[model samples]
Target: MAHTAEIQCPRSISEEDRARAQFYQLLGTLLSAPPSSELLRGLASLQGDETLLGVASRNLAALAERTNPQDAEREYNTLFIGVSRGELLPYASYYLTGFLNEKPLAELRTDLMARGIKPRSNVHEPEDHLSTLCEIMAGIITGEFPCDRNLISQKAFFDAHLAKWAALFFTDLEKAQSAVFYTPVGSLGRVFMAIETDAFAIQ
Candidate 1:
């Protein structure tokens, strides 16, 4: 369930930005998961109005069908965990505190507990893991929360974690040596992060 102190969004914004916030929430979710046939099918129902996301989504949809896991995995490893290490760590703690399982993880644990969110027992990754955070954003947007504080929870969590290192990660993803199908994914993430960050700023 989403925790609410006084019941409000993380920021005050116009109606239009709320819709955009939903977009970021959904984008974060999709990025966390490898492409599935059902997710691909659902994405086609959305229509965009010639925005950067609109164009990118169309292109992504066009390419998703041909995506091979073996190819994507090879690229993912080369970019995220190469022979030594990738150009970036793709972690909030590493980016913010120069190490994993640092204060950020401690802080995130506090927040998660407060909000009644628990890390899945089967998932051994740290709560501050990028993929886990992305999944949380999806849950927030999708009303998996026990309460319907989706937008507010989405904004708060994004402001707390993802709004920090996601851009840099996406940028690295864009330039990584093994990126091919992932190049566009990187571009989309980068662009979406920029848009979301700015919206949060102005809100």
Candidate 2:
């Protein structure tokens, strides 16, 4: 996903929403491009708790500590970009319709338009790209878009655009043969998707 306008959360936002937005942003940043040396170093410093998500985070941190930027970039290219095509096509349209720029993407664009969230002029990728979707979700939560900044709105968007396919994509990421440094990233995404699904169900 290409970079969008930066979003700053209001101080009145709840801690839970703040954390949720941050996680979405992190996933967006990592998946949009390979981690830089500075990003890798920062990731290596992360400490996680005892929960499944935390365990995945800790695992990611350990892997980051052992990974250099060059190796990580090579791995990223192998997993997401290759001589022909990468091991995975990480778009909702591809995952759901087995093709690029299908109905899912059209629907997402419509939703985004309604929310007053437009893609940057230079962005060539479809809005349904997983990384782009994550960034949009972060924007919704952080009030960067015109939609209501509440759980109901988040749930609607998640269920429509993400719930159908994101976790499955993450599972594929975890099992991909080219995965190394990204293995725990997949785990973290899978676990976080589950958490979000569960949390949304109760809302």
Q: How would you encode candidate 2's per-residue C-alpha lDDT over 1-203 as one tens digit per residue?
A: 45354454554678888889888989988888999999999999988999998999999999999999999999999988898989998999999999999999899988887777778998987778899999889888878776787889999999999999999999999999999999999999999999999999999
Error of 2 at 166 (Å): 0.5
Cα lDDT of model 1 by residue, 1-203, tens digit? 12222333454455765565465555555445454556555554555558887776666655555666666566556666668975556678988888989988888888777766666556665677666676566555544544344456767878998887888887877777676666666777788888877866765
Per-prediction TM-score, please? 0.72, 0.95
lDDT of 2: 0.89
* Number of the predicted model whose lDDT against the real structure is largest: 2
Where does model 1 exceed 4 Å of error? Answer: 1-49, 83-87, 147-152
Per the 3 Å backbone cut-off, how many clashing residue pairs does candidate 1 have?
Answer: 0
Which candidate tops TM-score? 2
- Candidate 1 residue-wise lDDT at 63: 57
